[model samples]
Target: MDPVLIMADDDSDHKIERRRGPSTSTLSFSGIIAVAGLLASGVATYNAVQNDIASLKRGELYQERTNERLSEELKSVRIEQRETMKEFNEKLDRIIDQWARGRKQ
Candidate 1:
């Protein structure tokens, strides 16, 4: 190669090298931070979803228990009403019989 041309090419290469210098370390650090942030966000989202599922399950269980309790209470009330109705009918029949006897006498 000619000396003058080689020297000019070396100078140009040096300028390009300087312009592109030492970027890998900065890019590597930035990539690491980005990955860390992504992982943290994913973990937080997973935990929130798990908590929501747990809450939904608990709510379902509570609703089921409430329904059972209401059904039992309704059954007890119906039984009591029937018993009361039976007693009232017996008393009414006795009153009618006594009134008829008194009228006949």
Candidate 2:
């Protein structure tokens, strides 16, 4: 009895190797880039919010200073008006008293 033998010789027959699937490294690199892009966008949004808050604070401070100045001006104007009215009333009273004395004489 003789045993059957099988042998493969290089360049004698064409054999195709089936690929399993896509490479893991390619998918991993794509995922990493996506995460990095998301993180960068979040940082940019946070910085923009901070700058807006700072600007709002500055606007409020400016408004407060303007209100203080207006209040002081209003106080000064009231004082001047009171002084003018008092002087006018005193002069009218003196004129009326003199007229009454002349009538008696």
Candidate 3:
């Protein structure tokens, strides 16, 4: 193979030196660093996802509790309304009966 020629200085004496690139060890080390960075990024993403899931679960639980409280409130209101209607009906019946008796006399 022909050696690479490089001009060192602008002089009468010309020197030829082979061109050198990055060594194997340097390339391997750089590759390892890149892989490590990728792994770290993946771990960060996973942790973020887990945190989001936990937040969602907490929100769901809060909503469920709120729904239960509202349901209880609704049930109490219904019971109170039913009682009021029963009392009103009883009063109306008594009034009607009293009127009928008065008319008979």
Candidate 4:
């Protein structure tokens, strides 16, 4: 530790004295509290970011599943439409054939 010299006045002559000041190693109460609050805030921010990332992942998964289901449903509807068209065309052809034969007779 460094000491500061102080001068004093006496009856006959002047005298010299030593004094001490605040130490660098020790922190005040308010300083300690401020540091602790900073640490707590940092921890809270980190956790919040982690939670947001997880939520985004879940949302992505849900969207992919919904898209897959929609594709499958569209494929099934196309197949059903194809079958209906085939049946209608066969019945029309049969009717045309019968009309032509009746006209010939």
TM-score for every candidate vs. truth? 0.70, 0.65, 0.68, 0.62
Worst 10 residues of 2 by lDDT: 1-10
Residue-wise C-alpha lDDT for candidate 2, range 4-80, written one tens digit per residue: 22333434475758988758998899899999999999999999999999999999999999999999999999999
Q: What's the count of clashing pairs in each model shown?
A: 0, 0, 0, 0
lDDT (Cα, 0-100) at 21 in candidate 1? 56
Give lDDT tens digits, candidate 1, residues 1-105.
999888987787555334565588898999999999999999999999999999999999999999999999999999999999999999999999999999999
- TM-score rank order: 1, 3, 2, 4
* RMSD vs true structure, all candidates: 7.6, 10.8, 6.2, 7.8
Tens-digit lDDT track of model 4 for 46-88: 9999999999999999999999999999999999999999999
In order, the Cα lDDT scores of the candidates are 0.94, 0.90, 0.92, 0.85
The true-versus-predicted C-alpha distance at residue 105 of model 1, in Å, is: 3.7
Candidate 3, overall lDDT?
Answer: 0.92
What is the model-wide C-alpha lDDT for candidate 4?
0.85
